[model samples]
Target: EPEVTQTPSHQVTQMGQEVILRCVPISNHLYFYWYRQILGQKVEFLVSFYNNEISEKSEIFDDQFSVERPDGSNFTLKIRSTKLEDSAMYFCASSEGQGSHQPQHFGDGTRLSIL
Candidate 1:
């Protein structure tokens, strides 16, 4: 089975600093996404990328956040001017199709803690 993998299982950053979270999605997957779950909160959708462009995004994914396919094997989320509220478990997910019914494979996630 294919799997999505995220680097730096845990990350600590000071407020106002910039942090980049990285992920490697399943090779065969065509769609990629980023989601975050704050402590004691539900998993919230951040952004979705396809065809080398952002396909969809949630309000939580403000200008401070950006996603990129820097290379063939990597997808990254850069949080500029990080804030304390940004602390969360950021998960990378991938799917073969864009349909809502398609199952998404998720990574273990990078635990981001803003100090």
Candidate 2:
């Protein structure tokens, strides 16, 4: 079965620092997305990328956040300036097609800790 893979399952960083979370979704998937969940809070959508461009984004994806697929395989989320509020489990997801009808597969997630 195909599955998403995330690197550095856990990361620790200081406030004001930068952090990058990485993931590799199923090879045949066409749509990729980033989402995050603060402790005790519901998951929030961050951004979605497709066809090499941003297809959708939530307000949570601000100037401090960015996403990229630099190698055609690995998808990355970069937080330019980390804050205490940024401590959360970031999830990477992918699907064969876009829209709510398609099943989106998610990675285990990367827990980001800010000091």
Please name the candidate that would achieve the greatest lDDT relative to the true structure: 1
Candidate 2 lDDT over 1-115, as tens digits, reads 9899997899999999999999999999999999999999999999999998899999889999988999979999999999999999999999996577998899999999999
**TM-score versus the correct structure, for each prediction:** 0.97, 0.96
Full-model lDDT, candidate 1: 0.95
Candidate 1 residue-wise lDDT, 42-86, digit = tens: 999999999999999999999999999999989999999999999
Where model 2 places Cα greater than 4 Å from the true spot, the runs are none
In candidate 1, which residue ranges exceed 4 Å CA deviation?
A: none
In candidate 2 the C-alpha lDDT for residue 35 amounts to 91
Q: How large is the C-alpha RMSD of every model relative to the true structure? A: 0.8, 0.9
